[model samples]
Target: MANPKRKWSKARTARARSNWKLSVPGLVECPQCHTKKMPHKVCKTCGYYNGKVVVQSEEQD
Candidate 1:
């Protein structure tokens, strides 16, 4: 088996893992319902996508 020759430095390890933080998903408003939703996906509240109805929503008014 292969092994590292030297110990890794703290700065090097931190720099490599600096971008490991989680980022919030980008959300957009549903045009039909005007509610927050992920882009290109069906809105859970309105069951809509691209200004059209894709799924039959359960909580309809």
Candidate 2:
């Protein structure tokens, strides 16, 4: 096994870590249900995707 030869500098490490952020995920409204959901994914509330129902029984849960 090998180890790092030099300790990482604070500035460099901070700059690299600066890009680590919690950006809000992209969301699009379902045309049928008018609910916010992730783009191109089945809506958890209504289970619709691409203008069609993908799940048969979802509201029971």
Candidate 3:
């Protein structure tokens, strides 16, 4: 197997790893309440998904 000619510097390694980052979760508007939420998941605020109420929300209790 071919080996690297030279060792990578710490700065170069860090620069490459700097791109490894936490991205913001993709958020879409809830159709029923107009609040931001993750797509295809139950709306945390109103507990609605796919045009229907899946879980009863606290506000309605």
Candidate 4:
């Protein structure tokens, strides 16, 4: 088996790790409820998508 010829430098390791970052989830506003939600997904608050009710949502008490 082959091994690394030399240890990775701190700067090089940091540069490589800099690209490994957490990205914020993409969000869109629900047309019916005006709440933030993931794109192309139903709105939890109103159970709607693309101006249509995909799921029946329970009314808030």
Q: Work out the TM-score per prediction.
A: 0.65, 0.64, 0.70, 0.64
Which residue segments of model 3 deviate by more than 4 Å?
A: 1-8
- Which residue pairs collide in model 3, if any? none
Candidate models: Cα lDDT each: 0.83, 0.82, 0.90, 0.83
Q: Model 2, 1-61: lDDT tens per residue? A: 8988669888888888987775888999988789898998898888778877788674545
TM-score of 3: 0.70
- Taking the tens digit of each residue's C-alpha lDDT, what string does model 1 give over 1-61? 9988768888888887987766888999888888889988898988887767789866765
By summed lDDT, the worst window of 10 consecutive residues in model 1 runs over 52-61
For this target, which candidate reaches the highest TM-score against the unseen true structure? 3
Candidate ordering by TM-score (highest first): 3, 1, 4, 2
lDDT leaderboard ranking:
3, 4, 1, 2
Could you tell me the lDDT of residue 31 within candidate 3? 95
Instruction: List ranges where model 2 is wrong by over 4 Å.
Output: 1-9, 58-61
Global lDDT for candidate 1?
Answer: 0.83
Error of 1 at 40 (Å): 1.3
- Model 3: how far residue 61 lies from native, Å: 6.4
lDDT of 4 at 60: 44
Compared with the true structure, the alpha-carbon lDDT of candidate 2 equals 0.82
Residues forming the 10-long window of minimal summed lDDT in candidate 3: 16-25
- Report the C-alpha lDDT of model 3 over 1-61, residue by residue, as the tens digit: 9998769988998898987765777999999999999998999999999998999966796
